[model samples]
Every structure is written in structure tokens, then in C-alpha cells.
Target: MATKLGKQTYQPDNPPFIISTGTVAGPFEGQGPLKDYFDHVYTDTLAGERSFENAEKEMMANACFTCLQKVNVTPQEVDFYLAGDLLNQIISAGFCALELNIPFLGIYGACSTSAEGLALAAMLVDGGFAKLVLASTSSHNSSAERQYRYPTEYGVHRKPTAQWTVTGAGAALVAGYGAGPRITTFTVGKVVDQGIKDPMNLGAAMAPAAAATMVQHFADTGRGPEYYDLIVTGDLGKFGRELAVITCASKGGFDLSKNYNDCGLMIYDTEKQDVHAGASGCASSALVVYGYLYRKMLAGELKKILLVATGALHSVTSFQQGASIPAIAHAVSIEME
Candidate 1:
């Protein structure tokens, strides 16, 4: 019954099972290295929708419905839908909720929304508050660019340190009774700001938070680096992942060079894709975890996974107002056994 573990950590008495998962990607992602992991890939980013926001909503809906189909559950059967996206007011999640016609809880964790929703949904199911819950998140590169930086018509060149926002959506189904990987322990991270104000340089801003959360998870769960078969971070890209490893080592006096991978780096091939740093967005981690790694867990190739999802919690208004980017990361432990 005791769910709390250390500061900001939660060790659920009964870990909810990850019953099913779904992933959908755009044309660019379809051509990427992990293209086969996606359940559906759109030939166009708009998916025939007039607006990018509508496309995003459709993408999210496709993912959620795909997940439901996999488990033979209807939207009405899902007790709660906890979802979010990078758009202003989380319009994608909101519209998707309306279409799905299910009880919804809209969240905002930037790129970390996927793991954040998973952790919250698992808590609800494990606590007996709900028999089944849906945790979903999405992002579209075009939508994000138009909202955060410039309109697609402007065609601004991306910086070398900048990361391409992934155009994809992922959905995870958590239930009290299911046959799949279980959510074990989670470490909720605190907001970390190193006074880095450049929006393009998110790697430098978010690395500290990823490191802080990873170190806290180790201390709280008493699980060293070797305990997890893989340590995965969400949307940190290549540079951020490198700095996170170094930062964790310096803070916790342990090296994280082994069995560590970033979803951003794993989503795309840096050389092939024009993604400068790597991929970053809610779906970056979503597609990798739900699309790629979940299958690995089910195949017995992986047993234990420490998934740390990082988000740059900065807004367009905040950036224009000269506010520094504050990053946050949430860590969740997943076990196949």
C-alpha cells in the first residue's frame, strides 16, 4: 500500500501491466532507421488534413485507436485518457480526446509527457482508482516549428545544435490485469535551470535535470547502473545524452557509459536525416519506447529498463521574454518479469 519511495520517488505496491502500445509516424520518420517500428506511417505530414494541428490530432487518434485494437478494447472501456502535446493549450490531445469520446485528463510536460502520462496512469490503475487507463502523447515537427520559432513559410535554417521535432504519436495501455511489462518504480524529477536561455541549446539546459533524476532513482531504489538492462532517456538527442552521462557521473560518482541510450539518438540516423542534433519531441521517446523497446522487452531480449524522459519546459512567450529554459525529467522503471 506504500507507494512513496525516497524523495520524489514512487514504488507502487502493484505495478500496472503495459497491456498494449501503438505508434504512428510521418513520412520523414517513416524513412528513418526505426521506420519499421511504427504501426502506421503517413505519406504526408498533413495526412490529408488542411491544418497541421488537425494532422497532429489525427496522428494521436490513430495511435490510441491502434493501441486499443491491439488489446481489443474500445475507447469507452478505457477508464481515463491522460494525454498531452507540445501545441499551445495542448490542442492535439484535447481534440483527440473529443474524437475518442472518453474521459480525459490533459497534461503538459513538453517532451516528457509520454513517460509522465505513463507513470500517472500506472499509479491510477495500481491504486484501484481505475481498471484501465490510456497514456498518450504526440508532436509534429511542422506544428512545433510554426508555434515555437517561425512559420513553415519562412523556412528558417536549423542550427547545428538544434534538434528536429519528431512528427509522430504514441499510445500506451496500462491495466490492472494484463500480460506484459510492469511498471515498477518511478523517480519524479525536479525542475533544473542552469541559466541557459538559448532555446536552440536545449541539450545544455536539460542535461542537469536528466542527471539529477537518474542519480535520484539510483539512490531511491538502491539500484546501481548495472541493475537495469538499459538506461534510456527521452528526447535528449546526442549532445544532451553525452552531457547527461558526464553530469551523472560527476554527481553520483558512477559512470553511465554502459547500456545507456537516448531515444532522440535512436529514432533517426544523424548522418542520413538532416536532424542536426537528433530527434526531440513527445513522440521521440514514445515511438522508441512503445514502438521499439516494448517489443524488445516482450521478446525476452530485455528484462529491466530504466526510462528517464526529459523535457525542456520553455515556452515561446518565455523565450521571447528572455526567460531561461527550465528542464525536468521523470524516470520510470519497467520490468518484463
Candidate 2:
């Protein structure tokens, strides 16, 4: 059963465990700091596929397959599979689900899809409705760029605040009983719009939402910054991470100086990669959490951590209509015992 801690948070009595994970990275990400941590890395963005969209589907499918193979669980034995991506109608996830042939639930939270899927999977397992659930998400730089912004063929000049969409996918298998990090709590965030209308400045649009969710998680669980070994945000990049720290202190009076970091900053070398702000996409936090952080927890490096995955909820149509970006963040607390 799941206990309602407050309006925005829930605590599961029989916490679900993340038994296994698989992360697949593209060439650019393979060249980053955590290159050696990823389960699989492709040499190119196309990945030997006909199009970038097909390549994304391939990556997502490979991630799920790797996750299942690691635990020796077949697709037929899985209870449910939840996934999402940045493509139109979540085509990447839809196609991958079709291939898996498992009971599927497609979700969309932009880049927050990773945490959102995990949260829902935890609830289903804790409620005894499911024995095993797989949560996953994917994003491609070329696919996202052509849909959300300018096409890569145009060679458009990117702004200093712009972030690079990660070209990768990540998947994790969650079960009711397992020898791995347990998902203890989850915090759902509200849609927050700070009136920032720049499509290029995703960090500025999402910072307030990340702060709101993080502060609420602390309040609901009756814990402070010292409770967790690490506090990480999804894809806030460098600018939004700084803004999130300042916003948390000013609004909630909670200082996040000691143990806070952003997945975007950890995924790439901002100086050498020419990534202006940092990485942003469904895979930004997904790869780091499923690949690096999860392994670190297993190795006894980190006991507890809070993952806050943030997303900007604006479509190309909305941006073209002069609408401001509305962002949201979802938090999940994972602990190893």
C-alpha cells in the first residue's frame, strides 16, 4: 500500500526495488565523462538505421532487451511496460512497445518521463497489481531538433542558453522483491510557468518547477537536505541548476548547497563538447540514474538519493503560438539497505 504523506507526495509500504537497468548512449555521449558506465554505446547517431527516428526506436528496444536479459526475465513474463520519448506521439516508445508485445502504457512528460514512469511502476507494484514492471524513455538529438526547433540541415546558430538533447535511451526493471535500491517515496509536481517565452532557454523555463517539487518533497517527507547522500535534477543544465538552488532557498528557505547536482552537467563536458548550457532530453537523467548512479548505489558509494526529473511542456505548435513554456518536475527517492 502507498501512504499519502501530503498533497504532493506518497510513501510506499512495500517499496519496489529496481533490480536491473540498461543504458544506451550515442557517439557524442560515449565521448563524455561517464562513457565507460553505459551498457551500450553506438558509434553514430543514425546507428545504421534508415532514419534518426528509427535509430531512436532501436536504442530504446536495445535498452529494454538489455534490462530483461540482465535479470533473465523474458518479455512474456513482465507484467507491464511503461515508456515515453520526445518524438511526435511518442513514436519511439510506441514502436518499441509493439516489438516487445507486452502490456503497454505510453506516457509523455517530455524529459521527466523517466521519473514519471518509475513512480507509476512503483505504485502498481506496491499495490499488488503488478509483480514486475519496466520503465523506460528515449530521446534523439536529430529527431528532437527537427520537431521542436530548427532542422539540423539548416545549421541554425544555437543560443548560449540552449541545451543539447541527449541521443540515447535508458530502461530499468522494478519488482516487488529484489536485491537492489528500493524506491521509497515519490513526489508529483505541479505545472509551473514563470512567464519565460524563449524556446531556446529551457533551463530558465524549468528551474522554478524543479525547485517547487524539491521543496515540497522535503516538506512532505519531513526530511531535510542532509537526509539524502545526493539530490539530482533531470535536465536543468547549468543555468537552471543554479536557478533551482537560489529558488529553493528564497521560496522554501531550504538551502541545497551541500549535495545538489544536475544530470545535464554530469553527462557531458560542457567546455569541450561545445554544449553551451548542458544536456537536456529524456535520456539526460535516465542514463545517469540507470547507468552511473544506480551502479554507484550497488557499489555502496551512495545509500540514499533523490532524483528530480524536470520537463518543459511546450510543443512546437505552442511555441509558435507565442505561448510560454509550462514546466513540471517529478521526484523519486531511492535507498539501498
* lDDT against the true structure, each candidate: 0.92, 0.96
Q: TM-score for each prediction?
A: 0.98, 0.99
Local accuracy of candidate 1 as per-residue lDDT tens digits, 228-329:
999999988888988999999889988899899999999898898889999899999999999999999999999999889999999999999999999999
- Model 2 off-target regions past 4 Å? none
RMSD to native for every prediction? 0.9, 0.6
lDDT of 2 by residue, 20-91 (tens): 999999999999999999999999899999999999999999999999999999999999999999998999
* Backbone clash count for every predicted candidate, in the order shown: 0, 0
Q: Which regions of candidate 1 are displaced past 4 Å?
A: none
Residue 99, model 2: Cα distance from true site in angstroms: 0.8
For model 1 the TM-score comes to: 0.98
